[model samples]
Target: MPFIRSAGLRGLRATITSLDGDADHYARLGGLDPAALDADDILMPDLAAATTLELAAADLDCPDLGLRVAGHQDLSLLGPLALAIQNAPTVAEALECTSRYLFLHAPAMRLTLEPDPDGVDGVAALRYDVTAPGVAPPPQGTDLCLGSLHRAIRSLIGEDYEPLGVDLPHPPLAPPATYEAFFGAPVRFDRPSALLRFPSRLNDVALTGSDERVRQLALQHLADLSPAEAALVAPTVRSAVDQLLGTGAPEIGAVARMLSLHPRTLQRRLADEGTSFALILDEVRSSVARRYLETTDLPLSQVAGLIGLSEQSALTRASRRWWGQTPLAVRRVAQSQRTVA
Candidate 1:
């Protein structure tokens, strides 16, 4: 059995809430027992595995009802929770309370802030590292988790909080339109880690107006969590390609530097892993091309440039080589499927 990592529990909670009604729709389509997902007792790992299986079986269109349920529940709970912390005095005290109390409703996720280089900017971010024992090749759950977190935080802060950027450990794909809709910013995937970058202005917002009593309670709650649970940090590789693609075309040395390794060492490591840097780059570009062709109304030429192809002809050849079909042909097939659905 694949163990769902603890780091992902908060995200799991958020996803479950967001997809509550969609579960029944999917259960019917996928021949699943809807009763298994009743509110009184939600199946976490079972639901995650079942959802992943159904998504693969259904061409990734299955509504992730479980995730929606988690999201909805999380949103409902975070408000009161945030208010509880906000009642406390001092930004530091409120944060301390929040960090300690947040886990009562969702699994503890790490929050940290560091001074930006100029000392004028403060970078605040949250992270959760899930570990599922014996789970080989975990799917990109962080994407969904962060998707829910973005919604939850925005709800707390109001709609005007513009984030600097978001980083994920997987390549970009279709689905979770929330990232683009909510953040109104570029989302970078396949980076060194998962992060949400925001200006330090957010730090000034007091967590709660409450006195020190609430602060003390929050801190004690945090201290009560098992030390064993605190050690959960899942391994993830931030995609160098995602970073490079955000800028212009990237050189090999530059990509290597971002990964904090020498170019030669990076090449040798990739080769040992039975892949080459060139092959992975092509794979990333191809994946992006497919997503653009399927989801967006962008012209083929623009899509080509977006993925670093200099000309439409080059993109055409690459798409043909990767998918054994022309870009237009692929788009037609995707459109046809959408129409059928």
Candidate 2:
């Protein structure tokens, strides 16, 4: 099955909640766990995720549901993909990185930059497509992807950056004015693909806060994380645990369900590999907790919640076990190193 990183659905729950709809209900109806959408970088069944978007939009009577979800998210939703893009020195390089590594985000998706097809002067087009077989990209999913892309481009170039034109492969989901107001450009539907036309000169614009070393490191990390061959049981289990963390303490059965394995089978496989579920869960929590402390200014309670702890006390205990210090102390040390560097 073609899979997308769960980050693709980052704002789904929030958008549905904001629209006075039951997000979990839609998720279940679409054959997914509601909590699965909350995790970043874990693989999710692409068609099921897309169907959830379609169902929510149709049932909630919100034609622009995808765009609304996009509004709730930013580049951070892309995880390491965002890291690579933000550190790239120029708009062109950042876009090139995105085109090359988008498969890391969604195996079935494609992003490309091409010359404007209309023979317009000094113009270019950024095209987005989903290459999954047996069906066209659904409208809501397309809207979410394109809306997020538009915002990402604006952030990369300038706040004033607006597409010259927007093209969609399906009929307008809402009034034409709705897309125009959101995109700040004319939108044409029934096009061959989703294309955002912009000034070609903008590609050379230098990005702020870009570090070449950081960009290269992020690219290497992404390359290492990419699914290149048949997956192993432990890494897949680790990913499932990571995905379930924010929902709560991950259970073996739940993890097994995520992997489509019986709990006993999962245990046997782990044992065969000289490990167990508990060990993997601990490693995931420890790694995630450390990363949050070192990289973000999030409160201790929030960090605890993200790593599946119910309270700061649990995190405090875990931090002591892992690092022999409080989470605050870890953050302080990391900050000091960054400042010195």
Error of 1 at 86 (Å): 14
lDDT of 2 by residue, 44-111 (tens): 79888889999999999999998888887788887888999999988999998887677777877767
Model 1 is weakest, by summed lDDT over 10 consecutive residues, at 129-138
Q: In lDDT terms, how accurate is model 1?
A: 0.52
Structural similarity to truth (TM-score) of each candidate: 0.49, 0.66
Residue 82 lDDT (model 2): 91
Poorest stretch of ten by lDDT in candidate 2 = 129-138
Candidate 2: give the clashing pairs. Answer: none
lDDT of 1 at 331: 80
Candidate 2: C-alpha RMSD after superposition:
21.8
